[model samples]
Target: MTDRIQEFFRQRRAEGRDLGPCLVVDLDVIRDNYGAFAKALPDTRVFYAVKANPQPAVLDLLARLGSCFDTASVVEIQQVLATGCTPDRVSFGNTIKKERDIARAYELGIRLFAVDSEAEVEKIARAAPGSKVFCRILCDGAGAEWPLSRKFGCVPELAVGVLEHAHRLGLVAYGISFHVGSQQRNPRMWDGALKSSAAIFRDLAERGIHLSMVNLGGGFPTKYLRDVPAVKAYGQSIFRSLRKHFGNRIPETIIEPGRGMVGNAGVIEAEVVLISKKSADDQVKWVYLDIGKFNGLAETMDEMIRYPIRTAVDGDEMEPCVIAGPTCDSVDVLYEKQPYLLPVSLEIGAKVLIEGTGAYTTTYSAVEFNGFPPLETHVI
Candidate 1:
C-alpha cells in the first residue's frame, strides 16, 4: 500500500476505528481535478455528472466550485438544487427520462435536455415545451473501458431527423451530443465523433436551422491499473478536432465528466475474511474480502474495470491470489481470471485498499443484498 493510504488507515486505527469496507473520498483531489479540466478547456462549460458520486459532500463541493451539473433523474436534480445551484445550470443528460420527470425538470427551470429518438423528442416537446434540446449521435466507443453498444445514442441520420422533428414540435434543437464512452483512452475517438457532429451541423444548417451549442459528453479517463493521458492532452485533441471540423464556426462547448473528474479521488478499504486453496493441488490461492460485486464494486462486471489493490502486509516476496467478495452469489469473485499479486504474508483480518474507485462504486451498489449493507463512505 502507498504510504499515504497506510498512514490514513494508521491514523484511523490509532483513534480506535474499525477497519471495515469503506470508501474514502479526498475532496482536495476532486477540487484539483476540476481545476485541471477548467484550465484545460478555458471557455467550455463543465456539467459534472452527478451519477459519478452522489455523495452530498461531493455535490456541495462541486457546486461551490461554480460547476454545473448533468443530472439523470429527478432525485439527482433535487440533489443538485439543494446545493443552491440553479436549474438553468443543469442538463437532463439522460435520454430515457419519463414524461412526468421531463415536466418536473422543466417546472424546476431546467431548459437543457438530451434526446436520442423520435419518441423521446415528442415526449419532451409535450412535457417541456420550447425547451433547448440536444440530439445524441451513436459512437464507435473505440478504446473505451465501457463501450456503449447501441444502448444509448442513435445513428447520425436518425439524430438529424430527431433534432428536425424537435424543431418542428416547437422545441429548440440547439446542438448535438455524443459519448465516446467511459474511460476512453484514445483521443482519436473524439476526433471521429466531432467530425460526425460537424456533418450533422452542416445538414441542419442546410435546412436553415442554426444551432448554438455542442456537448462533447464525458469520456475523459483517469489513471488506474493502466496509465492515461493528462487532461491537457484530451483538451488538445478536442480543440484540434473542433477546429478541424467546425472551423471558425465552432459553437459553445460543454463537457459532462463523471469518471475522469472523481474516479481517482476515491479509495475503498476492505478487510480479508478468509484465505485458502479451493482444492488440493490447486496452484491458485483464494482470498476473500468483505466487499464484492453487488456490495459496491459492480464496475468489475466481466473484470473489465480493474482496480489497483494493495494489502497491509509487507513482504519481500509476493504471490498471486484470486480475490473474491463475501457474498452468497458465486459471481462475487473480483479477480479470479486475472490474479492479483499480494504479499505472501497476507492473512485474514488484513486490510486491503482498492484505488481509483470513486466514480462508479457507490452509485452502482445494491441497496441491500445478501445481508450486506450498502458501501459506507467517508470524505476527507
Candidate 2:
C-alpha cells in the first residue's frame, strides 16, 4: 500500500463517504511496473491483458506508455480502441470465440487472433480471412497459484495440424503461444514451454510455413502473502531459455502480463461488519466483511489466493480467525480451510486494508449480488 491510497481512505472516512468496500489503484505504481517490464525484456513487447483490470484510466495510461493490449472479447477490443489506441496494437488472445465476434474484431481491424483447434481456425478463416493466427499449447501449470490448463490450448502435435489448416484456409500462421499459469512464482517454468515452442517452430518450418513470434503468455506473479521473484529474474531466465532453444534465431516475442502488470498497484478497503464465534467453547472467531466471492474477492475460491489483510489493531496479540463475507450465501467464506491470523483486538466497524488486489478484484465483482453494489474503484 502507498501513502496516497492511505490518504484517500483516510479522507473518505473523514468525509463519511466510505460507505462501502472500494478499490484504490495508484497510476504511478502502474507506470513504474510498465517501465520495469519494458526494461527487463527490452526485445519483447508487452501486451497488457485487458481481462485483468479494464479500468479506463488504466487503459489510457498504458496506451500512452506505448504498451500493446491483449483483449479477450470484441467489447474489450472496442474498449482499447476508445483510448485512442490503434487496433493494430491489440491482439484477440482468446482461443475460443464466437464466429460473429471474430467477424466483429476483423471489422475493427484486429488481424491477430489466437486458436488451438482446426474448428476455430475455420471460423477465423471464414470471418477474418488472412489474419495472423497463433496456436496455443497446453502446459501442466505446475507452480502457479491460479492454474490455467485444460480450458484452452491444444497439444503440440495438434497445434501443427491446426496452424497448417489455417495456412490452407488463407490465414497467416503467425506463431505459437502457451500460458505457464497465472501467478507463477518459478522463473524456470518458461524453459519447458519454450522448448516445446522451438520444436513446433522447427516442425512447421520443414512444412514450408515459417513462424515469426512467440506469445509468452502471462504467468508472472505479484507479491501477495508469499514473496515472488523479481520481474528481472523472469526476464533473464526467459531470455536464456530462448537462446538455449532457438540459438541465434530467437523469434520476435511478446508477453501478455495481467497480474504482474497491475496487481500490486491496487488496494481494497473493507469494513469489518461483525465478529462472532460459533460456540461458547470455540477458539476461532468469524470475522465478516461487506465483500465476498459474489461481490469482489472471487480469487479466494478454493483458498488459492491468500490476500494480505491489515487493520489498525495489527501488531497486537494475534490469533487464527475464520474470515468471511457479509453475504447470506454459505460460500461467502473467504478463508476457512486455512484460517487467517488477525489481531485479537479486531472489532466490528474496523477498517481493513487488503493489499495486492488491483488486477482481479474489480473485474471479478458481481453486479447487485446480495444487494451489495459492485466493488467501487478509484484510480489515483
Candidate 3:
C-alpha cells in the first residue's frame, strides 16, 4: 500500500468527500503481470482475454504492451478492434458458433477461430470459407465443482470426428484447444489438459488432420485470498510436456489469460453506509458500505471467489468487522468472516476499500438497476 493509493484516499477525505465504492486500476501492476507472462511463455502468442475487463484503458494498455486479443463474441471482437488490435492478432476463441458472429469477425479480418461441434463447422464454412480453426475438446465435464461442458467443449473422441469433418470442408483446421476451467489453483490441471492435447495431436495424425497451432485456453492459475499454484512454473511444466510428447511436430502455442494478468491490479473503494451488531450475545460486528453486490463488486454476488481481501478503513483504528455492500438484495453480501479491519471507533459516514476487483467486476456487470451512472475512469 504505497502513497499512490493512500494519497488518493487522503485527498478526498480532506475535501470533505469519500470514495463511494469505486473501482480503480493500477497500470503498473497490470504491466508487470503482462510482462511476466510474456517472458515466461516465450514465442507463444499471448492473447489477454478481453472479456475479463474490457475497460478502454485496460485494453489500450494491453495493446501498448504487445499482448494479443482473445474474444468470444462479435461485440468482443469489435471491442478488441476498438482498442486498435490488428485482426490477425485476435482470435474468436469461443467454441459455440453464431453465423452472424462468425461473419462479423470475418468482416473484421479475424483469421483464427475455435469450435467444438459439427454444427459449428458447417456454420463457419458456410459463413467464412477457408477460415483457420481450432477444435476445442472438453477436459473435465461440467459435473465438476464448475461445469463448462454445457454448450461447448467437444469430448476427446468426438474431437477426432470434428477435425476430420473440418479437413473435408477445405477450411484450414490449424489445431486443437481446450480450456481447463477457470480459477484453477492447481498445476496438475495443466498436466491433465496438456496430456490430453498430446493424445489429440496423435489422434489427429492417425485420422489424417494435422494442425498448425495448439490453443490452450487460459486458466493459468492465480491466487486469491489463498495460495494457489504458481503461474509461471505451471505454464512451463505444461509447455515442457507438450514439447516432449510431440517433438517439433507440436504446433505453435497460443494462450488466453484474463485474471492472471489483471486480477491483482485493481481494487474497489466504497462508502460506509451502516455499522452495527446482531445482538448482545452475538458479538459479530458488521459494517455496511454504500457499494452493493450489483454496484461495487458484483463478482461476489455471483459467488465468484476472489482473493482473500484486506480492508482499508478511513481512520486509524484497527479492529475486525464484517464488511457488507449496499445492494437491496439480501444476498448482496461481499466479504464475510474474513478478517477485515476498520477503525475501532469510526464515524457514522466513513469510507472503506477492498482489493482485487480487476477481472470480472466491470465489463460483465449490470450496475445500473436504479439509473446509477458508471463511475469515471482514470489511467493512474
- Backbone clashes under 3 angstroms, per model: 0, 0, 11
Where does the lowest 10-residue lDDT sum fall in candidate 1? 1-10
**Winning model by lDDT:** 2
List candidate 3 segments past 4 Å from native. 1-3, 12-19, 141-151, 302-304, 312-322, 336-347, 370-376
lDDT, candidate 2, 1-380, per-residue tens = 99999999999999999999999999999999999999999999999999999999999999999999999998899999999999899999999999999999999999999999999999999999999999999998999999884999989999999999999999999999999999999999999999999999999999999999999999999999999999999999999999999999999999999999999999999999999999999989999998888878999999999999999988999999999998889999999999999999999999999999998899798888889899999999
Q: Largest TM-score belongs to which candidate? A: 2
Identify the superior model by TM-score, candidate 1 or candidate 3.
Answer: 1
lDDT against true structure, model 1: 0.90
TM-score, one value per model: 0.97, 0.99, 0.88
lDDT of model number 3: 0.73
Instruction: Order the candidates by TM-score, highest first.
Output: 2, 1, 3
User: What's the lDDT for all of these models?
Assistant: 0.90, 0.95, 0.73
- The residue-by-residue lDDT of candidate 1 on 41-81, one tens digit each, is 99799999999998999999999999999999999999999
Comparing candidate 1 with candidate 2, which one achieves the higher TM-score?
Answer: 2
Total backbone collisions, model 2: 0
Looking at model 3, residue 165 earns an lDDT score of 86
In candidate 1, stretches whose alpha carbon ends up further than 4 angstroms from where it belongs are: 1-8
Order of candidates by lDDT, top first?
Answer: 2, 1, 3
